[model samples]
Target: RGLKFVIRKVTGRCELQRICHNNKPGARRTLKIGRPTYCLRIILCQSALSAHPDRVEKTIDDIMTLKKVNPDTNPQLGISLQASLFQIVGYRSLVAEVEKLRREPYDCENPDHEEMLMKLWKTLRPDSPLTGRISKQWCEIGFQGNDPKTDFRGMGLLGLHNLLYFAEHDKATALQVLHDSLQPKHSKMSKAEWEQKNFDKAIGYSFAIVGINITDLAYSLLVSGALKTHLYNVAPEMPSLSHFQQTFCYLMQEFHRFWIEEDPCDIMEFNRVRSKFHRRVLRQLKNPDMALCPHFAASDLHLVNL
Candidate 1:
């Protein structure tokens, strides 16, 4: 009986000490009443300002999250903020920033979110020259050996290859880069080692980028109306250009049905007789092998993304 009573007294003493240690509720109340509240308000104001600033309706919060990747901050948190930026602003703006950064130098210490900036910029201004600039930026970033996720500024070997799909008519530099990246490199390393270390990732990004860029270029051409007028208004005296007209006609027919209300498809289909050229394009480009035209592979991304 004596031992049990002593045990109960000790247990009761420990429980009381634990309660004292848990002064959390009182401490929290004190914070709510004083300077802690003011500090919290300041933090909230900063966070809100970071979220929406200067009425550009084009906030950098998404890219700023990339800054959170600093050791003092959080990577996952940064990614989440990026995800929001991507959803709200689109990848084109990020692409745009990368392109612009290529035209200028970005501090290595700041290593800005040039990719996201480029992507977002392109999103807002589809016709901006910044699109091609991004591809060049990728090359610059790659030459500097930055991480793929953080510093992919769009002018790397892959960036060059991707940019060419859209740049077939305008970007000579992109074409040259594409040619250089694909040339076989003779190294002491085995093929497997080369692929593991470099080739596979480069090749994959190259293929995807090529396809995406092409689609964007094609969409711009077809949707912009000038390409269609150039094709349809060909001088009848020039029989040699008929084949080109036929190719444009065919592409119009194939995609026009899909985009009935869009300027690209609608303008081309306005005259049914003008549509005869459309049939010829399908015959020229489509094959049983399901092989994509160099143009098709690149331009299709515009369809899915836009």
Candidate 2:
């Protein structure tokens, strides 16, 4: 009875006491991505954020019960801990929220969503203003039909968002890649041959549609454990929205290069070449030093908190 009493009184280095002592949750650079651990499992099982900032605090409270340490001992512990944990585990939420965005369908009814889609057009085709929402001009950027919303089927709004992010963030590269995609395989061909081939069918690729497809590839890397090598190395602190976007940028550029290098007969060779490119990326990632972002510039967390 005496030993048990003492045990209850003395809290361990769990949430409550750790926070009270002002434990530095400084950079968690050593966190191993992909492989699940007992601690993370505990965190996931114990608490979840309920769609607000307060929920982050509430999550701390949930963990506090497990430690049995009095919050009153250090009045500031609760507030400080919430802020600290928010930074520490916020990347998990970032990934979850991003995945949620993937599941969210593109709503043409939502003005905000439409604005984003429009921004993609303006960014890519600045000189050519879209005459109407349903104009065939969308195909200039590489949508199959006059309507682009249909192109974002399985990927949803994330497809559009990623395409926009690539266009907006890496404008020069994105535009150059788009320009290259518009080029014909047989540049020296006569007008007669070009006319017979059909311009759309003769182009190297479709930039906007391919961006969405690459979004699917990036999402695959995020969900699967394959991206850990590049992600772990690049974002040593934590992954953020920009990190994912930067990955998308890298992929778009790399794919463009890869497509050109393969010297495909036509756009029909996309799948065969993309599969080969995927294999090449997988092989490169097997080396611990491989970084998708050629330069280590995607570390800025200011775009949005992770």
Local distance difference test scores for all models: 0.31, 0.68
Q: Model 1 shows how many backbone clashes? A: 41
Quality of model 1 by C-alpha lDDT: 0.31
lDDT of model 2, residue 189: 66
Using lDDT, give the best candidate's number: 2
**Candidate 1: tens digits of C-alpha lDDT, residues 102-164:** 344333244344454454334323453543532443432122222323333333322332332
Go through the candidates in order and give the C-alpha RMSD of each one to the true structure: 24.9, 6.8
Best by TM-score: 2
lDDT of 2 by residue, 188-298 (tens): 767776556355644578888889889988888777756655665555444667778788888888898998889888778889999998889888776655567632243
The list of candidate 2 runs beyond 4 A from truth reads: 1-91, 191-198, 201-203, 294-306
Off by over 4 Å in 1: 1-190, 195-197, 200-205, 233-306
